[model samples]
Target: MATLTILKYPDARLRQKSKPVEVFDETLHTFLDDMYETMMDSNGVGLAAIQVGNPLQVLVINIPREDNEQYKEDMLEIINPVFLKQEGEIEWDEGCLSVPNFYESIKRFDEVTIAYNDRYGNEKVLQAQGFLAVAIQHEIDHLNGILFVDKLPILRRKKFEKELKRIQKEQSQ
Candidate 1:
């Protein structure tokens, strides 16, 4: 599996809604493997296809252990996920592969019942709470053309935009 380039924030492609996975085959599995490698290489716990410039409703996640290490066996490759139910609320300090170094406190469901397809097109349902739920919601947002940064308040959003401009300018120089 090879690592893929993660598209950063403000990339127009990231704002594009992803299309549902129409076919599940070796090709899809290969892309999932590469997505897993890319996530691990970047120290990201989860990634969506849109983050890598692919407009597919695909995502991979590996919830870290107590030691904060992720195991391959624990990685989940999910396709065309939908939230069946969500309840309660929790604010998490969230970060994203696409958003780079910026992190923000965002409120999301504390529990979620989600339905998704596996790489082989097997439908699965999962009831998750806490961090796992947050991770799933975050990735799903990417699939829906929403960014964690978009959840920020107006003042914070303005601040982030200013900071992003500064960072891009530095990188260009």
Candidate 2:
């Protein structure tokens, strides 16, 4: 599997909403494999297809187990995932691969239940809490053209925008 380029924030394409995956074929399988590799290579816990320039509702997540600090081989490959339920609330510092080097405390559901189609076209439901729940919600937001920064307070978002501009300018120089 090949690693795909992750689109950084401020890229207009990232603002586009993703369409659902319609076919569960070989191409879809290959794409998911590549996405998984890309996410792992970038040391990201979760990634959305739109982050890699594919406007499809696909996401992969591999939250390392706390006890062993090792990620399970079975990474979550979700297609057309939809939130079935959310309950409780927790505030945690969150980061995104697209918005590199930025973290902000955000409130999110403490528990979430999501329904999704697997790589093999089988429908599945997952219940997640803590970090996993937060990660899933973050990735799903990407599918809807939403970024973690978008959830930030207006003043904080403006501050981040100024910082992002400074970083981009420095890189260009």
TM-score of each: 0.98, 0.96
- For each predicted model, how many residue pairs clash, with residues at least 3 apart or on different chains? 0, 0
lDDT of 2 at 141: 95
lDDT of 1 by residue, 25-84 (tens): 999999999999999999999999999999999999999999988999999898999999
> Worst 10-residue stretch by lDDT in candidate 1?
67-76
How high a TM-score does candidate 1 get? 0.98
Best by TM-score: 1
Off by over 4 Å in 2: 67-72
- The TM-score of candidate 2 is 0.96
Clash-forming residue pairs, model 1: none
How would you encode candidate 2's per-residue C-alpha lDDT over 1-173 as one tens digit per residue? 89899999889989989998889999999999999889988888899999999999999999888674546585899899999999999998999999999999999999999999999889999999999899999999999999999999999999999999999999999
